[model samples]
Target: MIWALGIFAGAMVVPAVAAHASVEDSEVLAAYVQARAADASGALGQSARLHGAALALDPNNKILAARTLRQAIAAGDRPLAVQAARILDKAGELAPDGRMLVMAEALRRKQWKEAGLQIDGIEEDEVFSFLTPLLRGWLAFGARKGDPLAFLNQASTNALADAYAAEHRPLLLLARGKKEGVAELAKAASDDRAHSQRLRIAGAAILADEGDRKAALTLLEGDLPPIAIAREQLVAGKKLKGAIDTAQAGVAQLLVRLAVDLNAQNAGQLALSFARVATFLAPENSETWLVTSELLAAQDQHEAGLAAIANITADDPFASTAADTKLKLLIAAGRQEEALSQAEAAVAQPDADADDWARLGDLHVRMERPEDGAEAYGEAIARADSAVPGSTPKWALWLMRGSALIEADHWPEAKTALQTAYKLGPQEAQVLNYLGYSQLERRENMEEAERLIREASRLQPNDAAITDSLGWAYYLRGNLIDAIKTLEKAVQGQPADVTINEHLGDAYYSAGRRIDARYAWNAALVYADEEAAVRLRAKIEKGLKPELVSP
Candidate 1:
């Protein structure tokens, strides 16, 4: 049976008859073309239905059949995905993605030989060339057939292949009881920084198995985000559990790696299917749960995303990151009060670290409790020491504290914190912009403020907020002409920004453009916060005072 997603508000509505009616081939093809265009624009559900409808009309169109298979997989319509796969298999026209769908289904059904055949039959073209060896190796390893590590090592010559091998090959060794592989695994991990997290997890597990529990604990007690399995367990002589314990779990881990890679490349919809397969195979794997939640959240399935994150056990080392993900998902879902409460509670926990404190501070600031935010940031800064085993004290923690203090109207403290951040990270554009903008707001150190802001704009020319800050700085210095020109450009880039619009209006009024000033103020009024809106309306009605309109 074909699946149809309900129409989105602005999405083009397909004819009701198109799906059920015995439509002409040309008409069906027309619908397919329109749907393909929409799909390219990210309307996956509508596109999948139209593709299904087109396949119904002309069942023998191989290209349409392949597209329907791919779209069905992307839409999470497993039944439709399977149905389309059958169609494509009959026509012998499966794309690489379609083949992956077939392979996932085969693995799900435990048809190991069939899955192996699917991997073997995948075309050795440019697109699949680099991926083929890893895919084949994983299948071989899962079936306990050949030396998969040899295949992985062969594929490691490629950068991406090396990263994948560095991530997963150690897991294979652990699974197969290959203690001898640890030395090689450690060297590979040290060579590739990109896969450090995976290597660390594998290395810790290997060390635990070697009876070096203390070393394993030391290996993991760093700033990097932890994987599942608690430090307490490692310290108590329990081995860290590998995600790939069984063949099915091994396949699932491979699928998860593929999904993560796809996600990094922004192929999120495609990544979703792989993640779904991974979760089904290894629900106990906390990383898979995190990836599944992230993919669902990316698709705006907030409730499902929350549930997925909630499935992670609290004792998992990755639980903190999962908690962080949950907070953001709640905020995105407009459950801000819940997010705030959760963040507050999380930071108050005994094990809470600098990142946790910083998260709480950010939440407080976002919820408009700037004073509370500054306190939380202060806690974060106090936690940043060698005892915690982080790489370095993050300048960002001080920067956030400083910005929150500025928001709370504590000028001297804000300046101190910001100066500390500047000394730590002089090249950071965000630090430069915020500190400079705050200086401009304070109406002090104009020369230094201008220099910092100029450098920030140079570093990030397209950042509308930075550009607006530069314009506001000009306006503050009584350079109405330059202010008008710069603010106009900033407004062009960020028209809906209440502050930018307000700045533009002030510039216009100072330059004797009363009509344009009123217009800009009205635009600002439309998007401004309540306080800003009140000020904007007053200017719109009573006009700017002489001081504001002065040269």
Candidate 2:
């Protein structure tokens, strides 16, 4: 079932229509089939158009109308979305989301009463009821009927809903020109969540507007690109603009937050619908465009994602994020060369920072140019070190450089980098596993490697790769029985991993299970890379040599 329908699973069941020989019925069926295929393939825009065509032929079909509404919202086709939404609304078959679409259109036109009616039409859906109070608050604020903050502050048992309400409470206060909002905003921005970061940015802008320069600067304390840009602007005595200046923008912020949460839950279509509505509410808001782009990319609509990202201007605080998303979309669309070119250009700028160099390194690594990746990572480490005098770069930077060096066969440097990473992040399981596995593979520091791998296994016992490393460690120690048992467990955890399968085969052969060893090797051959496939075939044919046996 589509994730959008998962929230109300089994609530609405469309009765199957009787087969008809009419040409109109045939055309509708063909279009519906084509729409389903397009949706499955992630061609959401095409799917929306096809669904619309099918619905046009069978205008009274509630199922077709609902499908068209969902597809239209996901594809950002506002006209079709409105048409389908109204159809369902008039028939009293509108889902919560359809009501939201109708409300969004009313909100767009400042038809507060119409929008309120649509909001009132929303039934108590488990997944959507949490938004009801917020919708009421924003609607009241827009219509000047009551205190918006009162509606937002109404107690709720839903923790997720409360968090969102808390986030919006300060913004609503600020929009009303209340000075008490500064303290509340400060409290909300203490968390590290993305929404909190946005609050921090908005709060800082509000402070700057109020001439509290010191407080504004203090709010923008992070090293993120957006914070850095905002800090620079504040330092230059420029007024930073607040995120939500109007009631429409407030609702847009709410929808964007909802969209992000839904997308994280793997409901891309539902998320896109909310994001599209947010774009209509706050068309110039860079954050809305960024969220829209990310959700579109999640659906494999890379070209459309790029188009959405292009809405962000270069001077926008989210420009860096937009650039990053554009790079991902380009790569996902098989335009690696363009992505590389953009990455290179970004790093070539005189003011390019560690992030730019790191992004270039990442792109190089993705393109299988590990040598270039190592070089770029080296530059990133250098710039990062310079960025904060006397402080070491982040452990992840060293780990990345180490991995790139290993891929490029620069083992000596890789070992040094990996050791540095381990020193900096001894508690990180990934760092422990990588460093230990590298030492094990090189036949160097065998006892130490085993110790590291053992600690990593303790840290993350369910991690298949680390478990496989522990098994391989036992095999190298000539503990054939334990090795076979551990390797078999590892195979069960990750049956398709070529290295783990090969290790199991090796352990089996050493345990005198010759037929079982051959079987394991044959299984490994099925999923092995070309190089590993040749080695596995040879192992299956002749088995392990006596001298090569661990025991």
Find the candidate with the highest lDDT and give its number. Answer: 2
lDDT of 1 by residue, 1-551 (tens): 01132233113434432443355745774767666665655566667787787777866666566667767765556667777887777777666666776776787677889987777766443555566667667777777789988888877679876766765676677657666555555565553232345556656765677676655555465444463244555765565764354556666666787888899899997787777666666666777778878997888767667877887876566666677788888987889999988777877788778878888988888778999999999998888762243312578889989999988989899999999999988988888998999888768998789889889999888889999888888888888888888889999998888888889998888789999999998888887788777677778888897534321
Give stretches of model 1 more than 4 Å off.
Answer: 1-95, 108-110, 124-126, 156-163, 179-195, 206-221, 225-233, 245-254, 344-357, 379-397, 419-551
C-alpha lDDT values of all predictions: 0.73, 0.79
The deviation in Å at residue 362 for candidate 1 is: 2.1
Residue pairs with clashing backbones, model 2: none
Error of 2 at 345 (Å): 3.4
Residue-wise lDDT of candidate 2 within 1-551, one digit each (tens)? 46334223322322231032124566766667767767766677898998898778777777788889988887788999899988888888887777777888898889999988777776354458777788888888889999887887762667877888887888777767776777788787786565666677887776677677877777788665577777877787776754675668888888999899888898887888899988888876778888898888777788778878898887666666777788888999999999999899988999887778878888889889998998998898888865522122467788999999999999999999999999988988888999998988888898999899999999999988899899999889888888888888888988988888888889888888888888888888888888777677767777786443321
Top candidate on TM-score is 2
